[model samples]
Target: EENRKFVLRKFQILYNRVLWIRDIESTIVIVIIIRAGVYTFLLVIVAFYFSNKLPLCDNEMTVCRISIAEVV
Candidate 1:
């Protein structure tokens, strides 16, 4: 019947729209996660490089204090 066909067409359009929205949301989430991971990785690398570059101290107590402060 014409009515049934019209209903089916409407359902298909709605289904397609939902699928598109879901795909867009998934892509956004993936992009955010990837960016966060990259930022974290870069932060760690910079921290490691700075730790090696900076002069701490000869004494154990001074080195511990300085290193702890630098890490934060």
Candidate 2:
């Protein structure tokens, strides 16, 4: 019947909309995750570079050990 066809079409539209929203949300989440990972990597590199540049006290072998651990 025409009424049954109409109901089926409506359901199809709703299903498509739900799928579209889910896809958009997933894309946003992936982008955020990538950005966070890149930022963390950059920060670690910068910290390692600066740690090596700092002047160490004569008895501060622990500082060097800690810096090497962070780079690894």
Candidate 3:
């Protein structure tokens, strides 16, 4: 019947919308994870560069170690 077809079409639309939203959510999550990983990697590299460039003092070394730990 026409009514049954209309109902089926509506259900299909709703199902497709749900699936689209789920896909978008998963993509956002993946992007966020990648961004965080890259940020951490860059931070570590910067920390190493500074630690190497600066002459190590006891206090400065402790501070550098603490900062790196905080980043991790």
Candidate 2: give its CA RMSD in angstroms.
13.7
Model 1, C-alpha of 28: deviation from truth (Å): 0.8
Which run of 10 residues does model 1 get worst, by summed lDDT?
A: 54-63
In model 2, what is the error at residue 19, expressed in angstroms? 1.7
For candidate 3, write residues 23-46 as lDDT tens digits.
998897566556556655675667
> What are the lDDT figures for the candidates, one per model?
0.64, 0.66, 0.67
TM-score, prediction 3: 0.41
**Considering summed lDDT, which 10 consecutive residues are worst modelled in model 3?**
53-62
CA lDDT for candidate 3: 0.67
Candidate 1 residue-wise lDDT, 36-67, digit = tens? 55554555567568896533333364454444
Best by TM-score: 1
- The whole-model C-alpha lDDT of candidate 1 against the native structure comes to 0.64
**Pairwise TM-score winner, candidates 2 and 3:** 2
Cand. 2 Cα-lDDT: 0.66
Taking all chains together, each candidate's TM-score versus the true structure is 0.44, 0.42, 0.41
Which rank order by TM-score, best down to worst? 1, 2, 3
Output the better candidate (1/3) by TM-score: 1
